[model samples]
Target: MRFRPSPATVAVASLLCLLVGLVYLAMQIRTVFSDQLKQEYAGLVLETVERAESARDQVRVWQQLPVDHPADASGYRTARAELARRLASLDALMNASPSAVPQVMSSALSADANLTDTDNLLSNASSYWRAQRDANSADVRVRTIHIARTLIALAALLFCMLVTAVGMYAKRNRLLAGQSFEFERASLHDPMTGLPNRRKLLAALEEAAATPAHQASIQKIAVLYIDLDGFKQVNDSLGHRAGDEFLIAVSVRFRESVRKADVVARIGGDEFAVLIRTFSTEEELADIARRLIACVANTDAQMGIGHVRASIGIASFPDLVDDYRRLVAAADDAMYHVKRSGKNGYAFVTAAGRSAVS
Candidate 1:
């Protein structure tokens, strides 16, 4: 029979794989998001520079415009409205990263702040300058408008960069979650048999014990320790590869006989273990043992050598030894007894004494 990894081993491996993959993905996400933010921020800086130049010219023109010109009033009104719109855009950009905003955006906002103040001051001075028929109103207006326009473009750049960064981060998180899932699957299963390995079996046993008692009785936990007969002989006679295949076939047969709640594992080599919970009586336990023995009692080793049989030992918590260690030892001893007597059977420690069947 081909020996296979216990379910616990498979699970542990699967979980480990998933965890590592998730960590990798998380790291990737940080890199992706940061890079995206940096590139986007760089583009925004270019736009801000251009807009600032435009606003500067507008401010200068406003200052130079002949104050006596009737259109001066209308142009001033339009400049004021444009200034208000630019301020709103700047506020939006700064608000995006109250604490996390890029340094470039911060410097730009400060520069824009001076322009904002200039615009406010020009608004107040406009009325007076026009009354005095000043020649510089148009130039002042042109300069101020340039600054306002620059800040608006800067605000747009910052806002877009933040949005892109968030999107990249979110995508990376999703990738990490998927990797984690795969890791978990690796942690709890045997790679060969795809069964619950030793770790998973132990966990399942503990969980079963914690459930409500069956039929008003406390739950009973059983470990059936199985030793394949003539396993070594087969390894010696046939190639290890064939022996491995045989063990695998035996494992499949053994698993097919058990309920889903029951957990089975190959500890290593030719030894296997099955854990059962909530058996109502010894008879229930006996029936399970019989099923297992029948499953493994092959008439040949597939190559038609001698028969393949097994010795099974059962130990139960509370009835056998109290704790986990003793329980396993008791079951192991019983299994040995079965092997010593005759191969294809089971043995269990009972209050009456140890009992074995050939």
Candidate 2:
């Protein structure tokens, strides 16, 4: 028989591959952003250099005119001031940048003693500014090249992750379709209650969120955040083994309480989430909420678990919020609101406001 990796192994391997891909993508994004900033800075530096060159040309024109002429003297003074301003701006930019070219240019500028000596001063300053511009251009080009290469690598990594994830998903489906249904169930479902785990829940949520057409047809979607009341105390007092049994029992009740189309996921140790795809009347939703609470509250005494109930918060999409993340957050907030007031109840949050589900 051909050796096949277990579903658990495949899931873990896929997760690791995706994690690595995401990390590389994040690093590349940072590099690209950094390069863009450097390019903008280089452009500013070049602009300053152009201004300096223009000032030098003006100074040359002023120098050709007679110094005795009133207009000529005024023009020379204006050109000198403009040149000084441009030089100052260039120096500031160079100081801010990590380029050695700025220091070399500054030294060249300092060597020219006579500010009014147009020919020599203009020649030296032009050479230095040109050199600085060339250096900045070179640096920008190198950074652009690096960004391009990083982007290519990021694209490749993303492709690899996509392929790996798809393969894992197909393998999981195959396992589910085969005689190893129990093993596949163990891989995707929580071992305690056999309910779908957090990973499966998130995957389902993401899929629902990504399909706009499906969402539009559904009319509205709701995520109910559920927390077991007094679960921690039970785990503390009854011992962890008993707590586990209680959880498994509670999970069964939770599953039975919901509609066949609805999905109940155990997202955390004592937390659950219900993804309600079909939107009915508020009265119907409240009925389901009551059923879940009653189921948990009426646990059999033989289980040795004290009175444990559920605090449920319902947040609907396009009704409570459009964004999936905020919708979940709203549900969570409402759940906590119930918990704070007193546990063993449910609350509903809509775009209008939050209200207790009596």
Candidate 3:
């Protein structure tokens, strides 16, 4: 049977895929920018070379004039001065981009002692610059091809992510009407992982809230909202069967991590919630969160895939919120905060404020 992935898997995968695409896009942009700068520098050097060639021609023209001509001496001096300035600019360009232009040509041009013929020096310099420019153009073309391939890959990943999200959303919608509003004593559990469902979790929360403070045996009730990280990638790379197996394996770890009195439920796709009915100290809750994270983190070896992490949000009764009903939402929001700041960590929603765990 072809296994269908859950909406939570698609959603997390889409988000992470988008992030990867953005990073690749940014790197390509930087490469293109650097290439553009190189092209600009090459153009500047060539332009300087052209101007120097023009000045050399001017000097030659003045040299051919009659020695006794009225403006011959003055014109020749002016042309030579212009040629000297252009040569200096060309030398600077050559120094800046020594790798682009041939060193032999630059050295001969600078000395002007070896190449006595002005025309020969300018012709050789022009040829060398054009060759260098062509090479640079070829390199740019190759890089452009690589960038195009990357963009295409990015587009494909995004399109798949979107389709998966839509399909999962529709599947989620189909099951919405079947959800029971009031939690019944009859065993309401998740079929796939054999854990308690969202309805059962809510029922437990309602029961905890309904209990009178005077008769309450437990001092505090805390909810740990957990969302698995990197599960989407694992699902995509491995088959859906592997994904299901992975979830099952993780659920087992979660079940083992909590106390018999505590409730662990598969509330939604790729999301789990733990109802800690009682805890002696805040550290106890923190320890539970740590153990949960470690459980997921260790899945990499068992699943033979890359690392998988968890982000947890903790909301305690009378400590974070006065009402136990708001515990789930508050805890879910706190878990999202962990996702935003950075995944693979847990955070708490307390009366003082939200504080993240390392």
Measured with C-alpha atoms, the lDDT of residue 296 in candidate 1 is: 69
1 or 2, greater by lDDT: 2
Q: Which tens-of-lDDT digit does each residue in 146-248 have in candidate 3? A: 7788789878887887787687677767666445322332357888998999898998888766657688554589999999988898778887788889899
The best candidate in terms of lDDT: 3
Candidate 1 segments exceeding 4 Å error: 1-187, 211-217, 298-306
Candidate 1 overall Cα lDDT vs. reference?
Answer: 0.65
Better of 1 and 3 by TM-score: 1
lDDT by residue for model 2 (1-358), tens: 9989885786677577657756765765666566556656666776776787788788778878889978888888888777777777766777778645424244334323255443354455457655655665576576567657666765776776678778878977886788487766677788878899867776667666665663445456788889988788887887998888888887888888887877899987999888877676777777888888877776735565667778999887766677776766788888998898887888988576665654
Residue pairs whose backbone atoms clash in candidate 3: none
Q: List residue ranges in candidate 3 displaced over 4 A.
A: 1-187, 212-219, 352-355
Clashes of 3: 0
For candidate 3, the 10 contiguous residues with the lowest summed lDDT are 177-186
lDDT per model, in order? 0.65, 0.73, 0.80
Better of 1 and 2 by TM-score: 1
Candidate 2: give the clashing pairs: none
The alpha-carbon lDDT assigned to residue 104 of candidate 3 equals 34
Error of 1 at 187 (Å): 4.5
RMSD values, in order shown = 19.6, 25.0, 25.3
Superposed by TM-score, candidate 3 places the C-alpha of residue 342 at a distance from the truth, in angstroms, of 1.5
